[model samples]
Every structure is written in C-alpha cells, then in structure tokens.
Target: MPQTEIQILNHLPVELLSARTEDLCDILGGPTVINLGGKRPRPLVASSLLHGNEHAGFYAVQRFLQMNIGELPRSLIWFIGNVEAAKASRRRLEHQPDYNRIWTEGPRPENKMAMKLKQFIKEQRPFAAIDIHNNTGKNPHFVNVNVLEKKFLFLAHLFSEHIVYFTEPKEIFANAISEICPSVTLECGIVGDESGVDHAYQYLNAIMHLPEIYSLTETDDIHFYESVARMMVPPDTEILWEDQAPTNPNYIQLSRQIEEDNFKDVAKGSPIATFGGDGRILVMNQKSKELTDDYLSYSGNQIQLSTDSVPSMLTSDLRVIRQDCLGYLMVRRRLEI
Candidate 1:
C-alpha cells in the first residue's frame, strides 16, 4: 500500500499528555508528531513509545510537560509512536512493522512517516535526539549509542554510568537521527516503574538546559560495553521447546535463570542450556553476520559460550522472546580518556 498523509500537531491538545498511553490511539489516531516552541532555538527531538508496551517515555514526557506547563526550556519535537499498538498493550500490532525499524526508506505507512519525520528534523537541525524505551526484563537503566564519538559519549553518560554501543540494526531512531546531530537511546528499566519514569524525565530535563555537549572528560566515570552478538530464539509459533514442547525435537532447556544473570561476567564454557532437541540458537554480531559456529560450543548435553563475556537484557517473557531477541552478548571496553 502507498503511504498516506501523517498527523503533525503544532500545539498540545488539552490534557493530551495526561491521557494514559493505552488511550492515546483515540486522540492521535496513529503515529503523530507534536512540535512545540521553547525558549531555545534548536529543537530537542524526543521520541517515545516506539514499542507500545514501554510506558516510561510517555509518562516522563508527560511529567516534564506538567512541571513546565506554560513553556519548555528548549524547543521539542515530540514523536509519539505506535499508538494503535499501545491500545492493545503489545510491542506492535500483528500487521504493523516495528515503529523503530521503519526510519529508512520503505513502502510501509510507518516508513513514510519516518521519512517525513526525518525531513522535518533535518530542516530543524536539532541540537540532539533522544529515543526512550523500557526493558521487558529486570535490568539497570542504561544508555545506548550507535556512534563512538566523544559528544555521543558525553550525552549518554549524563543519563547513566552504564552505556552500550551497537552499530547494527540500521534505521533506528537514534542511529538515523545521529546524522543531523548527537543522539542517544535510553533503556530505562521496567515498565510502569515510578523511578524509571523520573530517571527519564530528569535526563530529558537536563538535556533541555544543557549549555553545551562538547566531549567526554577523563573524570567521567562510565562503564561502557559493546555488543558482540545477539541471541535469537525461534518464533514461538514455529518451535515450542523445553517448557512447552517436550516431545517435539526442536528445543533445548535453558539452564540458567534468565533475569538474574544479566550483565554478569561469565567465564568461557559456562553452561547456558542443556541439550533436548535439534534446535540451534541464532547468534549474530554487530555486522548482522551470523557467527553461531564461531561463538557457541556444546559439551556433552550442555550448550556453552565459546569465550568469556557479559550478557544483557536476558528476558524471561516468552512473548518478547519471540518478538525481539533473547539478549545480547557483550564485552566491556575501556574509555580512552
């Protein structure tokens, strides 16, 4: 289908931000952009709810707006995404593509909306960009950047000490907007957490008043990690393993608990899962190149990592496991300072 016209609002609707995220579809219809004037000239692009299930970004934006009812510290290009999906409280509707993945040129309505947004943002030439989200599992609030520049590092460190850098999965909001200015993605932990909402609001507020985003200093204490590989599980419908499918020869039982060990340093050959069926986990790197044979090993009935590494975002939610990814394998990188 051809792309249709998108909605862009110049002013806030009465009590729009106050509405629950799940109720947004009734007001905004679909993906919408709300551009508001601020004391500063260059706008700060804030995108949230790209995944419908995440609520931190929506509430944080609301809180920020509530505190500064009359005016904002800086110009804001607020992008509210996945409203239809939000109504259903899922990452995305079954028919719709992931909002974050359609920023590149494409034929989908979401893709066209993204292109329209990109053009508008380019015209504004914003100071910086922020795309906020919540983790489906238990994890620390961290920042993610696609680029390795000092300015990006400085911007990310302002939000949290833990930072992740990934280069693959192109056309995501932060990576795409980084072409115009510095951009960062915030993974504020857990949906509906008050602290998570506050953390995001504080970070957004701080950036609103930033005098300048120059470079990271040696004094900045930030723990940075680079994702080496992503662990992908089979679609839930395709293969039901272990817990769901015992007789089906398609899955092995994961040995370790999913949530607790996130970001824990594990030695090479640490047991990951026990053999059960003929299924194999897909392991891909930052380049989107598969490295299953290169990074995984099996000892007896156990599947193990080929090298010592840290993992993050290991989710126990079966729905997320099927929709997104199991988690990522990472290695810590020292700051050049």
Candidate 2:
C-alpha cells in the first residue's frame, strides 16, 4: 500500500508507521519519518507489535503519539515492529517469518523490514528503546528488561532504583533490537482487558516524563553495568519450567529429585520438566501426565511461590540476584545465563 501522512488517531490502523518513514525521506517513496530537529537530540524510540495478538500495546502507542506529539523528546521515534504479523494478528509471518525470533541471528542480509529497522536504528543510535508487548496471561503488570550486561546498570539508574533482570542470558525475544540500542519491554498484560490498556497508558505517561531518559548519558551507562552485575543469579539453584503453550499455565518450580531417597513412582498428574538439545525447557503437565498415568494423582494448579521461598542462596553468603517488581515476588530460578 502507498504510504501517506497519518493523522495518527483515525489513521492509526492504516500504517502511520509507513507514513512516518515516508515523510522523513522519499528514499523509498511511501511515508517517511519525521525527524525532530533540535539542538540536543533525544534518545528514545517506542515500538510495539513484535507479536501478532499483542495489539493493545500498539494501540496504546498510537494513542500516546496522538496526545503528546509536541512534548515528545526531540529525537524520539515511534515504530510498529512486525507490521505484517500485527496486521494479521498472528505471531509472525503467516508461517515462515517469526518477527520475535528473527533477532536470534540478526536481520537476514536481504530481509527488507529487518534491514530497514537495523539501518534506521544504526543511523539514529538512540540512547533507549522501549518496546511494548502483551503477556501470555490476563495479568497486565509484568515487565521484562532484557538488556546486555553493559546496559543493565544504566537501566537501573534511569528507570528505578529497583529494576528486575532475567537470571540467565537466555535467547531473548528482543535481543536483535536491543543489540543496537538500550531497550526495555513493557508487557501490557493480556489483551481484551481494559485494565491492560490502562496499564499501557500509565506506563507510557511515566516514561514520557521520566527525568533519567534523554540522549545517552554516563549516569545511564553506569546503571546498565550495575544491572548486569545485579541480575545474574548464582548456579546450583534449580527452577522448574512452565510451558507457554496455550494449553499450559506459566509457573516456575524447583525440580523434584528423581534419585532422592524420597523418590517414588511418578505421580499420575505430576508434571515433568525436561530439556532439549540447546537446553530448551519442556514442561509436561498433569493433563498429559495423567493420560500416560505417570505416577501420583497431582492436579496442575497455577501458583506463584511465596516471598519466603525466594532462594536463600541469594542471601548474605550468596550473590545478590535480581529482585521482583513491586507487588510481585521471585517465583522460580533459571539456570546459568
């Protein structure tokens, strides 16, 4: 479709994104980007829709742009990632393109969208990039910060005195985007929920006014380093894996020792967590276990660990690992990064 200048509100669904880029330069001819030329450059880019069904964040982004275009930082840019998937409301390109997974290996040399975003980011080199997303569940409050160690501490200082990080360096969904810019993902909760929309709006408001955010700064860099050091969990702690499939519930647990003295016949409904070649965690839940009569009669119930259950190994004698967010607690541990 030919891109044109977007009014944002009425035309949001029609690709204001393509418009932004087209307006900036006729390089590709559609709608280009609108560069905010100012004495001091702004370093923020807010983007969304890496996942297809995650539409609330994208909508919120459009709404935010509408209300605060003038107050927006001079160098800030708004983007819609995975435009194809978002358009179809699916996870990725029909069956071949996985927008979230594309970052795993970096943009394909010839892939148009990936190459375009990569080139744009490289040219701008913003200080921070905030990507919005929807969690798999109904809870709208979860947020994930998957930053390179060098950028972790920078986030801590910029965002809050308390910012959480994944214990290990797993292949993250946003790795490709973050590799070029400081980044954060706001899980705006489950879509279809008005509260989720509200959560996204409030978050956008806070980020827009955040004092710490600007073109990259030394102070921001220091926090990034500290975040890297602070979020690494120690080895030896076992975290039970929860599957993300639609049929499964997400929760982390301590793996039960199969060789322990207390080991008995497998329970009929108990879950078994295993791994594949690259250590990809696989969770077999009670429903499947019961079908196979694995062992005891255990029902799958979703539960978060009590605050007291946070691994003690993280105390005075152990290394300080990342903590959970306000009103949330650390539930399970992940293996070494």
Candidate 3:
C-alpha cells in the first residue's frame, strides 16, 4: 500500500509554492492538510493534485494563498495530494491507486486517508468543497457535480457555464463531499498552462468571499450534461495511432485528432473510430452493462454514434486512454434552475 499518513498544519508555507514539486515534498513531507483560519465559522475546502501530472490546482491554490497574504475572508482547508507522483511528474505510479477513486470506502491506506478527510468534513461542516483538476485533452474549463441541487449548480456555474453530472466511477472525492456540502470538481484545461492556473486561482478567490451558495434564478444560458456511459478500448485490443492502418486484427485506429472532438455536440451517425478487422468498440453505462444500438453501433468497420450526444475527456495520450477509458458520453439535461 502507498503511504497514506496525512499531515495537518495550521499555517501556509508560502515559499513552498516557488519550490519544485519534489522540493515541496521534501519541505512539507506528504499529503499535508492545512487550515488557514479566518473569522468565519465554517471553512471552504479545496483539494488539488489528485492526479500528480495535473498541476493547475496546486499552482492555483499556491497563487491564491500568495495573493491573500494575511487573513482570508473565510476559513479554508486545503488538501494537497499525491506529492510522490507530483514529484515524479507522472499521473500516479503503477503500483499506487488513483487518489480520487479511493475516497468512498475501502481498506486501502488511501481509502483510510479518505475516511479521515470525511471525518474532518463531518466535524468542520464546510460551506463548500472544490476539487481542482486539469484534463489531458483539448476541452473548455468545466465543473463536474454528482448531484443537481441548486447550490451545487450555483457553485459550479460560479466556475464555468458548462457543467456535467455523473455518478459512475464512484468513490470520487467530489461525490463523497457533495453529501456534506455543496461540492464541485473544476477541470481547468491541461497541465502547465498558465491560463488554466490563472482561471482556477480567480475562481477560488471569488468563492472565498461569497456569503452563501444558492440556486440561480436563471440558468438557461448554462450548458448541463448527464454522463451516462463510458467508451472504452477492449483490454486485449491494441490501439493504432497515426494514419497508417494496423496489421493486427485486434487493433482499433482512432482518428488522429480524436481529442479535438471533445465537448462538441455529435450528430447521429458521426464516426468515432474504425477497427482493423472484426474488432468492436465497447460502450458501457454506469452500471457496466454494454450499451446496444441505442447509443452506438458499428457500420462495416467504423464505430458511429447512433444518437446525438457529447463526449468529454477524450485524450490522445495512449497510456491514459488505455489505463482509464476512451472518454464519456453525455446527453443534454433539461433542468429547472
């Protein structure tokens, strides 16, 4: 099991922001939780670096603390996670569990740490919770929530006009915290983009001073989607990149610019991928049941959409695609806000 011991501190070490990730680990130790207290009774919680390669959250939080300097408008609890992977500049080591996935319930050390965090939430009763992340694909900044409550949408819209609600891949930090307080996951573009860092920092600053998170009176302008299914490459299948077709029959040749389709509405019969031989693509809902022709189907060798939908988190990175999934399929949700 990976090291799950958490460190709790009451003060912010400003210099650590300027230091390298590995250096930050050396200074702060591991998975440190800090409480920057203010006059407010309940704190706002921000978590970052669940995936080590995604650095926007870390940098944004760092910059936010730097700008505030002294007392904040409200108390805040910051959870800095996956310092080991951050130090190595990868997502997570092969042996380690995904930090975000272990938050629900389990026996693993990471899950234990997650339970501890939940305890803290129960005790402190935070006003809101934010988990900052950076996507590996070309997509707009969006917020993800597990529940469609007014306060959740309000908090999500405060970060971005695009919002996604999903219940799959359970045990994520956002889902767990949403039960206690209005919580949302902010996807701030990709790693190392200064623009993403700036956007997240600004959003955090704005939320810090808010008296309360309430449902919006008018939300017609907001784009809401419900993630219903995940698209995946078969475990035994090999993915072929570039324009060249694969010699192996089990390979799937995805579009070279597959990730570019992210966040765009797909019309019915749009091609998503093509196979080398008789190999088929896999589409499964949150329950892990294979979707039939209602969602997607194969025409000759090409995989095409059978319904109008939107996909998110499509990535060209082969490793990420293989380890996680191709992306997620979403449908427009009409809600009264």
Candidate 4:
C-alpha cells in the first residue's frame, strides 16, 4: 500500500543532499512536509513529485536547500509526494492513485493523504501555492493556473509567457489550493533537464522572497489560453506511434509528430491521426461529453482538426498518453484585466 501520511519537519533535513529520491521513503518512511519559517508570515507552499517520474521539482528543491541552508527569505511549506513511485522511477504503480487528483473530499484510503494535506493547508492559509511537474513530451516550459486572477497570471508569467487556465480534471492540487490563495502548476519541461531544474529553482526562490504578489504587474508579453477539451485514446483501441502500424483493424494511429505540435496553432483540417475501419475521433469536453466537432473532424480514415486551435501536453510517450491524456485543446483568450 502507498504511504498515506506525511512526516513533518520544522527544519531542512541535511541528509537529503546525498539521498536518492528512491531512498526518500526509506528515510522518512512516508511523504514529508517541511516548514522553513522566515520573515514572511504566510508561507509559500510548494508540492513536488506528485508524479514520481517527474523529478525536476525534486532536484530543484534539493538544489535550493543546498545553496541556502540557513538563509530562507520567507516561510515555506514543502510537500514531497509519491516517494514510493520515485523508488521505481514510474509515474505511479498500478494500484496507486495520482497524488494530484485525490485532493477532493473523499473517504477512500487513497484520499487520506490528500485530505491530511488539505487540512494542513487550511490551518496554515498559505500566501500562495505551486505544484511542480514535468511533461513527457517535447514542449516549452509553461505555467497552468486554475484561475485568471492577476496574481495567478503574474506568477505564471514569471516562469513563462505561455499561461494555460484549466478548470477540468478537477481535484488537482493547484485547483484546491487556488480556492484559498493564488496557485500555479509549473510544467518544467521534461525530466532530467538541468535547465528545467534551474528555472524552477530560480522562480521558487524569487517567489519566496516576494513581500506581496497581488501588487505585481506583468512587464513582459503574456498569452492566455483556456483548456477546452481533453483528447484521449478510445478504450480497447490499440495505439501506434509515428509510422508504426497497428495489427488491430480498429486501432488509432497518431502521428509521431504529435508532440511536435505542442503549443503550435494547428490549422483547420490538419491531420491529427488515422484510425482503422472509419472510426471517429474521440475528444471530450470538461463535461466528459463527446465534443469531437469542437476540435476535430473525421475525414475518411483520418482525423483532422475541425478548427484552428493550439494543443498542449501532446506526447509521444504512449504510456503517459494512455494514463493521463493525449493532450489538451486550447484557445487564446483576451482577458479584460
């Protein structure tokens, strides 16, 4: 069984510097909650490794602590999630629930950890929250927010001008935290990228020292997009990446170049995939209803975009695509603020 409780620490654990992520659970014997109090009253909360395979956040945090052992600028609460999965270098085991997805109210054993974390947040009432993750595909680093408030947008702009606001896939950690304070989910590119680790470390460090984020203004160009739909492979259908063909006649064959399309505006009628036996594309809105017409159209055996739109998080990693989603369809939004 996955560890459902977290170990709390008032100071940085010096052993973390030499500890491998896999050994974290063995060290703490569970998830860990570290509070580094500083001059600032309301702490900045950062939750990392919700997906075990994404290690950039873990490394970034380690680097930050190593460099600034005794001189933190503000109160900080850090949650290290899914150390068991990190031991195996997998996103999550077959029996484990996605750590980020279990934040909603529930009594299930899997929900116990998230509930405990939520209770902690409620007691602390943090100034802001950040949940760091890494994509499985080739994509630029971006920030995702659950709300479009100025603080949220500004926080995201600090990392990248590419800001995505997603309301679906509810129960995400950032979404739950955003209800109380400004929160952003940072997608720090792929794992093992030194640049990603540096980017997150710098951003987190900057935010930790900030006296107030609500008064901040964006000096750089910022583009806002809303996630409109989630693309998923149909159940029981085989998936073939790139030029690979499927033996099953009803399988869907997505282009190997799918990841290449991330953040680019795909033109209408652009081919996204080819399916056997005249199967239609399966795209669903946040409501889980078939919204294929909103994003894609069927052309003979090929599925193409029905309208011009940008897609993010598209991945060639078949396992990730199956476990999470193919990607999300996005549309640019002009905010009055």
Best by TM-score: 3
Better of 3 and 4 by lDDT: 3
Assess candidate 3 and give its lDDT: 0.85
Candidate 4 pairs with clashing backbones: 242-256
The sequence of per-residue lDDT tens digits that candidate 2 reaches over residues 1-337 is 3222221221223444333311222322322233343233754666666565677665676566667544564455565555444445665554445455444434453144455665676688766677667644223144456653545444433433223455333334345556776676666555566666666766666665555544433432221111111112212323342333222233223233321211122232333333222221121221222111211122334222212212111211111112211111132323122
Estimate TM-scores for all models.
0.92, 0.51, 0.95, 0.93
lDDT of 3 by residue, 209-257 (tens): 8888877777878998998888888877878875866777787888889
lDDT of 4: 0.83
Q: Write the per-residue lDDT of candidate 1 for residues 172-265, one digit (tens) a residue.
A: 9999999999999999998887889999999989999886687887534777888889888754223343455455566666633667768788
Off by over 4 Å in 4: 216-220
Best by lDDT: 3
Q: Which stretches of candidate 2 lie over 4 Å from their true place?
A: 1-40, 104-112, 148-164, 167-173, 214-281, 284-337
Task: At residue 179, give the lDDT of candidate 4.
Answer: 82
What is the TM-score of candidate 4? 0.93
Angstrom error at residue 178, model 4? 1.1
Task: State each model's CA lDDT, in order.
Answer: 0.82, 0.42, 0.85, 0.83
| Candidate 3 regions with alpha-carbon error over 4 angstroms | none
What ordering of candidates by TM-score runs from best to worst? Answer: 3, 4, 1, 2
For model 2, state the Cα shift of residue 285 in Å: 16
